[model samples]
Target: MDWTGWIERWGEPGVLAVAGLLVGLGFGFFAQRSRFCLRGAVIEFWHGRFADKLAVWLLAFSSAVVLVQALVVAGGLDVSTARQLSARGSLSGALVGGLIFGVGMVLTRGCASRLLVLSAQGNLRALLSGLVFAVVAQAALGGVLAPLREAISGWWVVEGGPSRSLLALFGVGPWDGLAFGALWLVVAVFFAHHSGWGFWKWAGGIGTGVMVALAWFATYQVMSHSFEPVQIQGLTFSGPSAEWLMRVLSEPGKPWTFGLGLMPGVFLGSMLGAALGREFKVETFGPGYSLPRYVTGAVLMGFGSMLAGGCAVGAGMTGGAIFAVTAWLTLGGMWLGGGLADRLIDGRHA
Candidate 1:
């Protein structure tokens, strides 16, 4: 069907909202069932077991690469069309930002998306993290840290003149991208299959990755197509989390964007999932010291996400899926930061 004909039949906003709801439901369900979390994944890895979480994350990244490639072929979607994709080659910022975000995630015990889902489950620590994430993200975007980001971005040079992603760094074509994605999938599957974890968790990890890929498809094809002018498609978290807060206050004449609509849907869907599974519980800081720790962790996470340009899910999982160079840097930074935090915190606890 022609683009215009499809729009006329469904109406942009209505179709977009439905797409948001579907993406939300999928995200919520997967997160709740598999407990898929980047922070947890890295921690599990560091502990030398429960590597299944890391497998799940890799599975998601592989799936996204495949799915996005398929969408580009099928829907005539162009990766170069999106600003997020084009805004590549920020290596220095990504490394620094990722380290901060990663450390913050370890301290906070969750990434941005995890914080959102956990908050819905009445986790007070997650709630604090989400609040802090929003504020710090805003600060980095336009407030205190904006200048630093701009300077870093300006100083970095792209060897090949900004292309779609890091794939360009290696001069990879679509076929090469596919091959690299398959390599990751093979590694993830091997880990899951050989790990001592039961089939249920292994399958759940794979399922989580598939769900994330589905989210990419839904956003790019279903939601973006529903718009009149058609917005650029991408999956990243640093800016969206902050945008959601502003959207809440400026809802009167606000134009509905996929990111804005999908976030709340994920939150509500998570709440519903928790309730249905009888897993809903109100968890909070236990005592005097815990509250301060939680708050401090949340604040750090917020600022860190902003500096890195997204949270674990935003830059790590989603952007990684599409092979974005900055996302990879963010992932590395997160790992470095999270690793240090874990050692420090564990040492202190010991």
Candidate 2:
């Protein structure tokens, strides 16, 4: 896998960006086709239904875990240097930010990635909210909100490496993690079968997970071959969203990276998916959706994602696949927060 030729042709950042674009294209296409949304899954779960939404999400998640662990076991990938595992983490931020993000998604009717998908499909509401989410995410990353986020993140910290790796904390190895993933994959299969989903639904869900694994693998490969330092990363929305936002407004000359390519790749891929499916249609706010509600939700999600260090797909699926401890904690917080929000808010309306 000599990357010298590719790097010489496209530069380090260009090569990484291309890898990100390819991965993001697959993820966006599959996610759009499968109608994958964590918000939908959480809502369905809290409402006591193991239906298509839950099945799709389960399939995506379990598939990512299985594939990622398998890569580790086969020595095809090493995540030791990935930020999710290598950086100091904040338990408090993961929990609190997860909770806030969960509530925000429920209110906004979609998570960050989902919003991007819908926006690509011509959903005006999602377009606006996604823009707002990116703005607030940028603010949280280094704007006025940075101080507050830093304060919260400082409360309970965990050292990187073993302390942040769930497998290490539990005295388990990649084999064990692979087995766990396999078990859940079986569960996902059961639910998918029970839900009577069509081929595209199930296939698309699995494809989305595969993209997550590929992102990890691809980035690692780029890092291994590059002459310059490259951080191995997986699919994530928070940091990328902030990075892309800043790239547009402040740092247009910033070197191309995986995240830079990912944002637009998802958008274009989603557009292609929608066009092929004939699902592309302009939609906007109407009865039951208010401007204020969406704005508030976007703000919460932006802040929460930054505080928690990732969004639903970022922390929940991508990091979860690698068995990152803080990521798991954040995921737990999201589920709990989503459930509470649905019960308290949507329940009252019902």
lDDT of 1 by residue, 1-350 (tens): 35446557866655565566667666766676667788877887776665667766666667667766666656544556454476545667677778877777777778887888888888877887688778778877887867876786566644323453777767776677667778877887777666556554565566656655665665555534554566555545557678877777565776566677677777887887788777889887776437666667776777666666677777777777667777788888888788778877755332
Per-model tally of clashing residue pairs: 5, 0
Give the lowest summed-lDDT range of ten residues in model 1.
155-164
RMSD of each: 3.0, 1.1
As a whole number from 0 to 100, the lDDT of residue 52 in candidate 1 is 63
Clashes of 2: 0
All candidates' lDDT scores? 0.69, 0.93
Candidate 2's C-alpha runs over 4 A off are 348-350
Model 1 misplaced stretches (Cα beyond 4 Å): 1-6, 9-14, 73-76, 155-164, 197-200, 222-228, 287-289, 348-350
